[model samples]
Target chain A: MESFFTDSPLDHETLRRSVEDDAAGAVLVFDGTVRNHSEGHTGIVALEYEVKLPMADKLVARILEEVRTEIPVLKIAVGHRMGRVSLREPTVIIAVSAAHRDEAYRASRKIIDRIKHEAPIWKREIFADGTSEWSLGCTACK
Target chain B: MPKLVRVEIRYYAQLREDLRLSNEEIELELPATEEDILNRLAQLHPKQAALFLASRAAVEDEYLPRGTVVQDLRAVDVIPPVSGG
Candidate 1:
């Protein structure tokens, strides 16, 4: 899929191959993982993501379309895991392919940034201390 | 009972936690706008007025302008500042 939100673990091979083509010379993938720490929260256990489907799904598609038009990338695919995502596991993955490394790299970065800023998805960090807090909220979308 | 329009309100993130509610259905006077719905919610939840007032309302697929009329709307999402990557 070009963009989506899934409750299950993301499939990497399929995401990569979704943009695989002979016309492309470079394909870059970005895997955003749930880490052990976030700012003041340490020993994080997992990250819980909440998204309103159909709306979120639609917004993601709009983002991809906007990115595609702005960048020279030939193809783009994005996947984000919803609900509880354990540490070290990929929470989001973005793959972009272009005729050159520069375009691919630029598109990959731009897409993720906009997704983070625009998509109506929420993340709460679960700490080892038995407390959780939503990260500094998205100012742009709010 | 007075004329009314019921709008389902779905809360998210900080606002949901603060309100201790996932969603609720609210009844407003017949001529209600997205802005009026929010004001009523804030009045009903004075303690969390800031969050309620600051929330953005979305109907079926898109976020509605605060001043847009809400009579034809069936559901509205009260979105707080998001934290997604």
Candidate 2:
């Protein structure tokens, strides 16, 4: 089964524990963390992220469609969190279960890369110096 | 007298912050080029002037070359190089 979650905090333990089967030999998980610094405006404060909800949902659905059709995986689960998050907090998680290690590894890597490139969400970095900027990825500090 | 057409503008990321706006509906005189809109926007939002000068404009979600005809001027998205991974 393939799962996608956008609202809840990504549960790493649950994902790893749940994605199991006697027929499957491997399960891979990828976790994305938010780092501090991006786009030349760094004073070390906080970040606020927003997304066009409808658009983001549709985009994720499309990515999952591609993953299922293009990747050889028995099951996949992906999640992304929206709303205020602090530095080093987990923002995205992907889990893949397959008959072999290679399939799980490949699918998990592709899912995160595709999401970062295609997702409609944006993050606003607020500096302690009262300056702020926006970036697509964490540590975009340039 | 000159004809006027409605052009929609949508902003994202840094451009949105520069313009201090998300979107807008503007009516500009016909035969108006993107440069004309850029100049006008510069006047309306001086803070975005430099950003607009450095950035490119899109008409109907596609980049319009400099000196291109204004045509109907619908669904213009003023974009920056905010496309990043």
Candidate 3:
């Protein structure tokens, strides 16, 4: 099934190719990766990602559409990896093309921030000590 | 006679792990708000009450505004604040 969420590795090349446009002068790619440690944690082994199915896909599409409205992006593509993502592996990838460098850069940044903040996706940080805890991406939920 | 609405509640992340549940179908009386679903879940699993109460509610594909009366609801996703990037 074609979806923003994938259990396998995200195909960055394919996504980049999707946003290739003749009129666009710049194509920017950004990937948010899993690191060894998160806030207040160390020796992180991996991150387990879970998404609200069907709905998660809708949220992703909606976010991208909204970006198009807010930014003058010529073309854009995004993918988020599900299941367990290892350290240094990208959790999400975003590619955008625009007529100039500034629009491409801005759209790329906003897409990453908004998707992380609004998408109905969650992650658990697994420590090397064999412990795991949910990453509290936002505190305003309380 | 009150018509009971059968709503499927789907859990994610910590709530799923805490309750050991992925989804459950439950019946509720009419005139129920989306918030009531969370309250009912808390009543069923008191141990995770706080998390359930704090979660955002989404029915079907869209987010149901807090305290909005659930109309034609079929499934609800109790989602924690997102962390994905």
Worst lDDT run of 10 residues, candidate 3 chain A, spans A133-142
Off by more than 4 A, model 3: A1-3, A140-142, B1-6
Candidate 3, position A97, lDDT: 88
- Colliding residue pairs in candidate 1: none
Deviation from native of the Cα of residue A48 in model 1, angstroms: 1.1
> How do all the candidates rank in terms of TM-score, highest first?
3, 1, 2
Cα lDDT of model 1 by residue, A1-142, tens digit: 7888888998778889999989999988889898897655578899999887888889889988887888888889999999999988999999998999999988888877777776788898888877888876556334
Q: List the residue pairs that clash in candidate 2.
A: A38-A140, A38-A141, A39-A140, A39-A141, A39-A142, A40-A142
lDDT of 2: 0.68
Question: Each candidate's lDDT (Cα)?
Answer: 0.82, 0.68, 0.82
lDDT by residue (tens digit), candidate 2, A1-142 = 3545454566787877677777788988887766665555455455666664555566677777898798778877776777656667677778788999988888887777776665556767766676666664522322
- Cα error, candidate 2, residue B68 (Å): 16
The superposed Cα distance between candidate 3 and the true structure at residue A60, in angstroms, equals 0.8
Better of 1 and 3 by lDDT: 3
* Candidate that scores best on lDDT: 3
